[model samples]
Target: MAFFNREDIDNFDKIHRINLMNSLSGYKSANLLGSISPEGQENVAVFSSVVHLGSTPPVLGFILRPTTVPRNTYENLKETGFYTINHITQTIAEDAHHTSAKYDKGISEFEMTSLTPEYKNGFLAPFVQESPVQIGMKYLEEYYIKANDTIMVVGEIQFFYVKDEMLQEDGFLNLSKGRVATINGLDGYAIPNLFTRYEYQRPKKIENSI
Candidate 1:
């Protein structure tokens, strides 16, 4: 196996380093974050960093790169205090990926892409109408990661609009059944299926749990 130390990694070409580091962490959830400017211009962007932060409070967090550049999603979220996280499925994965394209300010990605924007229950932000699982969130807080100039934006889950049958009685989401797409690297898209579901394990029973 090829070994890359810190110096070697840092010296690698920018694109090479990005691909290597991004894929090194394995599959990440492919999602589209939808936000709207204060003026009502809708914006949607593909993201792979959405992670569950807490269950009791129903919080989720996503990492946003530095704001040195114009990040419409970040700016819109801060301005509106709301956003939506829509799961990328095989049907809309291509359109979802295109949301990552840098559009001119005030341009709506929904118009540029085939994906449709949907609003529900009077939520201020728009949701991807084609997505099977859509989550409406309220901005909670932002924490800066000093190590990487990125910010972890946390939000509270205010509403969920998932297909009824996809949700299990135990609250587990059968994402595999929905053909949810997972991101490999920056541009790689993959659809994953469920192999098995195992129960939670404790120390002594861990070995034979599955």
Candidate 2:
């Protein structure tokens, strides 16, 4: 077994420390956040931090690293108040990951990579056409994380488009059916399978024993 303490992690090389820390949380959702600037310049970037905040209003959130550097997705979404979250799948994993490359502000990642952008129902932002699960999001609010200087941007799901076969009757999404990809670390991409589904659990009644 390997062990790493706070001091040990701090002493490691920059890349080593970053890779180790980013992977400690295990597999994360792989998504492509699509946004368009006010001037209609589209931006698509890969992210692993998108998370469900609530079901009542279908809220979701994703973290943005400290804005010391250029963050086109963050800038576009903030200005336009709209974005799209699209699930990355096995078929487009490579192209999706390529979006992580830092490009000039006006350059469209869609043109650089094999990924294609689709506009649905007159939504302001574009969605990845190859993604199985596509969600149109309206910006809600954001919280500043004092500890790490990151920002958590929250949004409400305005539109959801999922493949017919992937949605279960009870409202569960079977990601395996779509070959959805998950992030193992900063760069590793994997396609997970459906193991087994368990029903809601309740405490078992205890009986008197002789």
Best candidate, TM-score: 2
| lDDT measured at residue 195 in model 2 versus the true structure, 0 to 100 | 96
Q: How do all models score by TM-score?
A: 0.94, 0.97
CA displacement after TM-score superposition, residue 45 of candidate 1 (Å): 0.6
| TM-score between candidate 2 and the true structure | 0.97
The regions of model 1 sitting more than 4 angstroms off are 205-210
Tens-digit per-residue lDDT, 1-210, candidate 2: 998799998899999989988999999999999999999999999999999999998899999999999999999999999999999999999999999999999799999998999998999999999999999999999999999999999999998899999999999999999999999989999999999999999999999899
lDDT for 191 (candidate 1): 91
Clash totals for all candidate models: 0, 0
lDDT for each candidate structure = 0.93, 0.96
Q: What is the lDDT of residue 59 in candidate 2?
A: 100
